[model samples]
Target: MAEQEHVEESRKDVLIVACGGSGRRVFAESEDILEAPVVFINSNDSSTIPLVPSGMEGCHGDPELASAIAFENVGAIREAFQGYKAVVVFSIFGGGTGTGMVPVILRCARDCGCKTISVIGIPLSFESARRKLAQGALGKVSEASDRMYVLDEDSVVRMCPDARVNSTFRMISHSIIFTVKCIADLLSGPFFSTFFDKVYTFAYVSEMNPVKAVEKAITASGDDPAGGIVVAVSSDLGEAESGAIYDKVAEMTGMVPDIVRRNDREDTKMVVFFSVWGA
Candidate 1:
């Protein structure tokens, strides 16, 4: 156990890769908050038109042959991933680039000795065709990824019923960003702990009252929540409010959660990320 922990600690480099148009847009918007190296994979120059920050990188491929290219250039992709402890991939399913490249990237990351986690956004049920494609991609992702989080678009719609199209996408982006940040905090923050053997499930709630956020997070974790839950709260709330959030998480999970707080936001709204491990 000590040797395994030492191995994990030694490979601390983390790389976040975003694929497809929606994924790239999310990466571009949330890059400031991510505070890590980012690689954006796209199928064409049009998708790369957006202004990317200095430290970020981009990989472009032909739309019709992106998956093929990924498979053929496995060596190059693995090289890019070398020395990283883990690679977290953010992609929206149903799209050509993201759906096709996700599995390939997962395989490449593993080959490079990096543990892989995929954060995928599934299409809403209303979009039947897209949902079908997403379902197909899910199988490949399951086989390749060491761990996976499927963020249902229907959940985003339910959370923001009155939100416009752009607002809905923004909410999805917030979920992805918060989830990634929470995991990073556990792995490298000042309050680091070895409780995260594997993240079995996760939930995200944004712009909600602290109590309601905890309730929603628990509900999102499903009916039976038995695990060491890690709750990370990002808000500008006071110490008392933060305490309330922590207490709620502990009460709901029936376990003393590993809690982390961030007060950098100017908004009154809070973003809560919950990651549950164990059976």
Candidate 2:
């Protein structure tokens, strides 16, 4: 195994880790949109991201072998996660490295006393064997991380049937990035600390009326908010639009919503976040 000369410590409050082939590709494609530091781990020696210093070669889609390799590098992995307030793991869970490494990586983050979130993508239904493998891995990954967001590849493709294959995956990557950004913003606020264990969900709406955006976001979340809600609107949104959105959410959920105004955005995009009791 080849080793990196030194592991540079992360300076950001939040750290993002991309695991496996799909994970690495997503990060490479969307890194420009992300503000936090990102680390990559994979079995491929040719990968641009530094490989873990274990002698083992690629897992060849065997999750057990991937798990063993990750366990071997626990000390190094833990070191990477240290000093960050939160760690977000990104992976596509059908293959070997992601299915195996993600759970271990999340555990390392938790051990380092960092809040853990995982954004995982499952394979399409036609890939029956890979889908089965992903399903098996989900339980372990969910238990290991504090917050889990699952993206169904089949559903995503179905939603945009006309999109080219690569474009569809790019859309999925954007969704993951959006989730990460929203979580990072929410984590900085006082509200997140109060509901750390709640079932948090998110939705983003662009090119829609502010009030309608809120409605669509809530409806898309598929979870009824029993507690707090956070609505983040683009900078260009008017005070009137913001106020109307707030009233709409409050009327719908009977909970006063927290509004976060973004100064960086020029377009009329809104991201809605809320928490509910976990089942």
Candidate 3:
């Protein structure tokens, strides 16, 4: 396969919006580390000012009636999202504000000619009503978004077997943040510059070699090898070790990947982040 080098402009027009109380909570926890500008849309006018970034806009409507209100006053929401090329929307799919407003927000983004990515959190199995609502909302989201990442609460729980409720919630939040960061890093960071239509992401920690790690991450991502792949490795591996992993990925994907390496002092295990992008 011929190596194709496609360099595009940096993703400076990216906008990250958190669409409900749960979304805002995750943003608040991760705002300090996030690299992109963020907007918070909520239903209550409580004390979110402290959680939100200064100078950024926050839209408040009625939580129970967010969908109606948003549809009625879409001009205002569209104005808020003006001047963005790509939009990343974060929300929990089961709640009233998050569920109702996500589709509206996604529609607005799409109408504005912006690429839209929705990161939606699914409710736990015990919350049957919430799960049902999430299932209903997911259809609308799928129609509205160009790409979607569904974070399953059950999968997170399985990952953290003995964790408490609060810890599980934190774990979920962290996973969302990590995903958003990885996407931003791949699109906007100085490492690589290819404009991709869809991205599939998966992360895994293993003691195996880089080829096995790539295989595991690819299987977990559930992405077909039809487009370019970007890999980020976080480990204490030396230069030669890292190069070996990169070579394995290039061999498997038949394309030169955008690679990012990080040194982890405390852990010896390699954590590989795999992102497969659609052409």
Candidate 4:
């Protein structure tokens, strides 16, 4: 593999690793996966997001296609990252197919010499027996990931004080998708694939941090609150969104972090931006 001599722009070469929420198995086996050009994995219809083409059984396109998607299968994640400028992982909660896939995908990115980060959405403990498998999923990435952003649905909703489970999911999912949309928007920009996007960075909340914000958010939610705007601003955050950003981060952590400033020295950006929900 050819090695990069230096770091360049912000949103250029890219690798996106997305896991299927519920219908992964279905899409995995559905001929649509092989048939469609690309399919965004999901358990259900997510309002009005752009369609990534459903992978069917007999669909045929370019044999040498630039992109390849495998629903939630980890075995093929590395393949998808091949030649990618940067890798962004988006998975709904942990466990099952996605759980096993996170580590392998992270390892693959590093092995391939590409900048990588894992963006994971952890489900609430009270969600259901199947929904709360984040422990295992988060454990692996937390150790190996350069950047890990964890969003706790249970903690985020409690901030409102009146949001229910359904409402919480909607709000959380929307926020997640919204953040993702920002990324996708970056990808859509002309300067993205050209001037920038080769480097990698991460941002997310951590297991050990301030206890105030997490406590307040959780107490209000009536459940365990350990969530906040967990993020690791990869590129230069203009130097303006610093203090206020930290203040908001303090709101989530309940206390200020020891280190939350800009560091753009490394060509390979690796940050773990987290959002704590409970104290």
Candidate 5:
């Protein structure tokens, strides 16, 4: 781990991986914003997009089956993830495939010397059975990950109050894509080693003004950024705009922010990543 941290330019690429049906659905819609090579691993060979090995089977919502399938195909997982400096696993936890296979995948990525990060969504409060399963599976997932960013499914409703359920889920998936882009850009830079092992919560804001976007995300997360914070913005911003973002973040967190630049197209999108204690 120590040797992997200090290298300057070698570990630059990030592989964006989507696990299971829910994750693949989101990935299919948000490909344009992903900004990296994207792939999937599923229990069943059902997706239109080619699976990593073409013959991997589904787990039928059984976590034990999922884990066994992942273990049996460890070679394929390692081969698919090889040569990337970092691997970002995307899944909606609580389902059989996600809860069962994600930790195993993370461990494979780490074993192959890639920094492992999981961007996962938890079930809504009303999903009592799934929620309980998600909580139980979280510990294994957390242990295998270098950094994990959580998205609460309930927050999707609050984020888009009146939209139809499908539209709201699409919006939330876009937000998740934006966050993935931000983290991928950050890993390409020199600051990744600073926060290697911790839990974080993320938010996406697409306001034209950088300050307002950052402020809104901070307020929404309700997490103190003092421990550490990353504010990622579009690479197209002007010097003044970038400076204003830096100033706003420093004012809020009382610490210099790790700013990452990306090609966020027309909208000035900002994704804020902040650490959470004991989560």
Candidate 6:
């Protein structure tokens, strides 16, 4: 079991891929955002994989998934991740860094003989010109990562009662934080009971008028809800108006999400991940 201290770069190796952090407009004499250290907290001292926030190069505004770090950091990541059995990547959707960086990190992990799974949040709402950007990047991401699990907010909102947009965003954030924290807590606790074999996820899509299709599918399967993170991935969207769909989601779920959009070919898909915790 690894100690919880910040070890030197000379120890084990686990790579963290931070995509294009070049978004920040650097002043001539400004300090660099890429220079920020990546932070990691393991679920337990025994579990091999260490969870860390992505380090980007040009980071600013919404540090959740902005900026770009270095592929050079991969060496450090590998060293840190060494001795761990697996890799857990928490990332955002179809942006310069998260999408771009995750693939690179996964490749490095694969080369290093580590099993990699990218846990991403795909866009489930109409916030911007999502069609143009997110799809292309996701194509690259899915091609690289093994077992890509996505959570979409678009379909998740309908699961909730009526709620406002702001409230919905908060709700979404709450779930994301909840799921991550829950896993962390379990790992940290004095038990190896339920995990190392738990895989539960929800998918949300907002293309081809799939809402009715969704209703029918859920009705058929009798899927119930226990709120958590919704990873939404989509590439099959037509011309979408800004924030219209997401706003509707806000009204329906009483919780909104921080949307991460991915366009993977013609398949515009969304996945919502939630949890029903044990007492």
Among these predicted structures, which one has the highest lDDT? 5
Q: How many steric clashes does model 1 contain?
A: 0
Candidate 5 structure quality by residue, lDDT tens digits, 34-145: 6477888788775333333566656667998888878888888888888898899999888898889899999999999998999988877788888888878888888998
Residue pairs in candidate 2 whose N, alpha carbon or C atoms collide under 3 angstroms = none
lDDT of 3: 0.64
Runs of candidate 2 exceeding 4 Å displacement: 1-11, 46-57, 124-129, 153-164, 194-196, 218-230, 247-263, 274-279
> What TM-score would every model get versus the actual structure?
0.72, 0.76, 0.67, 0.50, 0.82, 0.45
Q: What is the lDDT of residue 2 in candidate 2?
A: 18
Which candidate number would show the highest TM-score if scored against the true structure?
A: 5
Off by over 4 Å in 5: 1-12, 29-32, 47-57, 194-197, 222-226, 242-256, 263-267
Q: Report the error of model 2 at residue 154, Å.
A: 5.2
Q: 104 in model 6: Cα distance from truth in Å? A: 1.0
Q: Between 1 and 4, whose TM-score is larger?
A: 1
Q: In model 3, which regions exceed 4 Å deviation?
A: 1-11, 46-64, 189-279
How do all the candidates rank in terms of lDDT, highest first? 5, 2, 1, 3, 4, 6
lDDT value for model 2: 0.72
Q: What is the lDDT of residue 118 in candidate 1?
A: 81
For candidate 5, the 10 contiguous residues with the lowest summed lDDT are: 3-12
* Model 6 lDDT tens row, 1-279: 143232222112322222222111111112121111223322112112233343422333222332234353567656655664335455545444455456666666676676565555555557444423554555555555544444454544655537677665655554443333222222232212322222344433334543442332233222454343333334344435215444544454554433333323323333334332320
Candidate RMSDs in order: 6.9, 6.6, 7.4, 11.9, 5.0, 15.8
Q: Which residue pairs collide, candidate 1?
A: none
Alpha-carbon error at 75 in model 4, in Å? 7.9
Q: Please give the ranking of all candidate structures by TM-score, highest first, separated by commas.
A: 5, 2, 1, 3, 4, 6
Which candidate, 5 or 6, has the higher lDDT?
A: 5
